[model samples]
Target: MVELVFITPFVTGLLAFVLPSALSRQLLVLTGAVHLVLSLLLWKNTPQAWFAEYFAVTPEGLLSLLVISLLFFLISIYTTGYLAAHGLKSENIFTGFMLLFLSTMTMVTLSDHIMVLWIAIEATTLASAPLIYTHRSGASLEATWKYVLICSVGIAMALVGSLFLTFSMELGGVTSAMSFSALTPVAAQLDPAWLKAGFIFIVVGYGTKMGLAPMHTWLPDAHSEAPSPASALLSGVLLNCAYLGIFKTNKIMVSAGLSDFSGTILIVFGLLSIVAAATYILKQTEYKRMLAYSSIENMGIIALGTGIGGLGVYGAVICMIHHSLIKSSLFLSSGNILMGYKDRLIANTGQMAKQMPKTFVAFFAGFAGISGFPPFGIFIGELFIIMAAFKTGHYLAAGIFIFSLCVIFAGFARQVMAICFDTPAETGTGPAADGKDVSFKEPPGMIWPQYVLLLTSLILCFFIPDALYQTIVDAVHAIGGGLQ
Candidate 1:
């Protein structure tokens, strides 16, 4: 099942590229559903390993793999309905590339070798480049340029970090294997100077890809320009892959008795991201960009949680799960609104419920859930984070974390309310009854996937089952020895 989870997407995508555009698109539905089934089987049953080069199931990696794979499945279904009605040309290329992207992301989580993990991370950058430029416009080209350049540069630094890690252990009596088990046992004897320097590069490098504040400049532009499905994955899965790199490095640091030094860096970057996100949200005119900033803020919370260690690791993992669901729903709803409004600016749009009731309501619910409203997963995740931070005596970090979240909430509330409620600009008033701005009604396929993601996230909020709790524990444990 684990092997199928990885191979199915790659094989299907290649086949998809050769078929007619419509046929290729429909195949996505079959592929997605099958992949989801395999993931569930992998989640519950015995471990299934592919060839040494490919798949293995670990509790932590399986958790991330399931989320990413499930998201791809839902989005693939939506894409079929989307392209069928809209008739995008040669979109078979998209399905093929997406499959390749999934293959690489799958490799990233499951790799036992550090070098293989680095390569997979880099592969994702290549596979996703075309997705960002799907429209072939000047704006999309510009966005793609920024994404490729920044992510490539960032990945290079991580490569350097991986190499330094190798060298650090060599200075001790350890033979380096780059396996998590192999690295942890020998970490304490490694050279501190080289390890510290390596971690800095890893954090900054992968941090750029994760959209962590100062390194996050490329993110808003990329997310704003990519196809909506692509944006959802970028915000949801891609960020987690980047974090896996940092998390793995931190685990090595923890084993080396250096978590205290490494964690401070995460805390500082995390808080800066929160502050930046709150500031940007208050000033954002484009609704998509605002959602992008919201992503940055959420990533900050994860960083802060992980930095505090202990229960904080659990909090970070919980944040990862909820943010993926909530943020993707937010972007898909943005797609619906963008299709309706014909403009991304909040001030330029108005009275969504009047124009399109289902989409408007879904958008509102997603906004509320993402902002950490009650009975939502983000609220629970955040509450855990607060408790974890306080337990660690990170009083200042905890206070800043709470304060920043409140400001972000206020900013998002003011904007979503204004855009969703206020009447449309007088200039663009009245339906396109005469056929002016918006032509098609909101696409049902797109709306349906978001609805699925949104409702599932809300459900997950009320129940944090033991399996998931153990998965979180194992994932944090994958970063082994960090807290203690």
Candidate 2:
């Protein structure tokens, strides 16, 4: 069953390469539904992995798997409509790679071995590169090149870190397999210096893939250039896959009693990412690029929360889940905006409420949710992270965190207002801006996914199920998190 989670997508992806474009597009949605069902079964039954040493259903991995399954399912629905309306030149390739991308991400979630995790994360970069180049334009080509080059370098660093971990095990006289499960119990015996060095390299390596600051140069280009459904997956779930590597490595650091050293580095990287994102987001001109920067900011917040540990870890998990839901919806809504206006510039996209009312609803609601407004899960998650920071006496960090959040919200809010309410001059001049035409109604598939995504984020803010709450708590507990 665990293998089926990824195998189903891989098999479908291969078939999509030969299938007719129309048929392959249908396969995209079908594969997503099947994958989602398998993930749900895994969650309910907690099945044992066939290859126990190489793969296992840990709490954090399961949470990530759930998000990937749900988000992919929704995004697939949107893709079918998007391809139909926009008419991609290479629809089959896009469909095939999207499934392959899903397979790689699923592999990341279930991987238990250190090197296997590295392989899976690197595979994701390869599988999604073509999706970024779907437009076949020079700009998209540049984005794809930067994405593959930068991520390859980062993954190579991660491989070096994995080797360092192996050396740590050898130094400690531990003969067990280099799997996360095997390492945790004997972590105390591992050399502290090697483990700390491994942790730093792993974080820096995977942090680059996760779109953490300074290393996130490739992200804005890739996200802005990729087709919106691909962008949604990249922002929503791909970053989490990279974070999973750092997260498992962090667990080893905790078990080895190097929490202080490892935690401080994470805090510094997290804070720097947020500040960097805030600075760029304020001056962002392209709407998609603005959303990309927002992803960096949210990833930073998640890292910061994880570093703080205790309740902050719990908050980090919550933020990760909700950010996936809301940010993906915003990207899909941006797709609608792009389709309508035929432009990515914020200044050119105004009076959205008057032109495309349904999209405006999803876009504005998503903006509010991402900006950490009340009645959204991000607001709750950020609240808990701040409370935990203050509780742990990180007063200066807390102050900086709040100030960054305020700055981000102010920038995001200004853009949202311009998109929703400000009137545009000669709106119908753009390719598809004449939304008043009877033929111009936003497609049901494109419009509904964003609605459903936003609503799920809103609902979760008020009511979390017992099982999910327990799963989140268990995930945090694995990383040395508690109420404190």
Candidate 3:
């Protein structure tokens, strides 16, 4: 049953390749639903994997799985409406790859063995690279190639780090299984020097894919060029999959009593990412690229929170959850803007409240939510993180965190306001390249998914179920993190 969660999608995706385009779109949605059901069942039962050595259920893994399952289902719904509007010739191929992408990400969540986890993460790159190229435009092609090249290089470094981890085991004369679950209990016995080396390489490698600073160059282009649904998944769940690797390794570091060393590196990298994002976001002209930078900034926040531990770790997890929800909704909303305006520039698009009223509600609300306004989960998450930072005596880091956030918020608001309220030039009323007027009819299918995601985040801010809360607690507990 655990394996079935990913296998079902993989098999269905293969079948989608040969099926009719319309049927393939249906298959994409059906696969998402089935995957979600299987994920829920696994959550309820917490079953052991058939291949216990390579895969197992963990608290963090399950959390990521649930988010991926939910987002994929909703994104698939949005994709249906998007496909209908664009009428791509390779719609079948697009749907097929989307399922494959889901399958690989599910595999990432379930993987336990270090090598198997590496394989799964690498497979995600393969599955998703094609999705970035779905449009086949020159810019899309460049973005796809850049994504594949950079991520593949990063994965290769991660493979070397995996080998280093095993070597660490050998140096300590440890004979444990090369799986995170198995190694964690005996992590203290591993050689400190080799362990630290492995952790550094692993962080750099996986961090690259997770959209951490410097290595995040591939992200803005990829996110901006991919189809909106694909962008949602990339920003929403895929980064989490990469973070899972770093999180697991950090667990081993905590178990080995090397938390300070590991945490410091994470903190430095996290701050660097946030600062880099702030510099670019203020100057960004393309709205999608701006959102891409926002994703980078949020990833940094998650990294920083994890490094802080205690309340900070808890806050990081909350940010992770809400970031996925809000960012995915924002990306979907960006798609609606793109469809109506036939442009990606913020300067050319305006008066969304008048032109696309339904999307305006979602877009503006998402803007507020992502900016960390109250009633939104992100606000709660960031607040907890800042409090934790101060409690831990990291005043300088906290100050930097707050300052970067404010800068980012100002930049984000300027762009969002231009899009949502500012009136466009009279030429904006002209026909688009598709021969449709600037007022493209808004589809409920596209509009509702964003709303559902935002609503879920809003509800979660106020009330979290016992099961979900416990799962989050368990994940943080492994890293010496707890609200208490």
Cα lDDT tens digits, model 2, 1-484, are: 8888999999999999999899998999999999999999999999988888899999999999999999999999999999999999879999999999999999999999999899999999999999999999999999999999998998989998999999899899989989999998889999888888889889999999999998999999999999999999999999999999999999999999888888889889999999999899999988999999999999999999999888899889889999999999999999999988888988677788878899989998898888888989898888988999999888988999999999999998898898788765464345333434323569899999999998898888788899888888888999999866
Q: What is residue 184's positional error in candidate 1, in angstroms?
A: 1.9
- On residues 133-250, what C-alpha lDDT tens digit does candidate 3 reach at each position? 9989999999999999999999988988899999889998899899999999999999899899999999999999999998999999999999999999999999999999999999
Cα distance off (Å), candidate 2, residue 324: 0.2
Where model 2 places Cα greater than 4 Å from the true spot, the runs are 425-439
Which sections of candidate 3 miss by over 4 Å? 425-437
TM-score of 3: 0.98
- Candidate 1 per-residue C-alpha lDDT over 22-125 given as tens digits, one digit per residue, 9 for 90 to 100: 77877777887887788778778847565543345666677888888778888887677666655566789987887778878877777657787888899999
Whole-structure CA lDDT of model 1: 0.82
* Reference-based TM-score of each model: 0.94, 0.97, 0.98
Top candidate on lDDT is: 3
Which ranking of candidates, highest lDDT first? Answer: 3, 2, 1
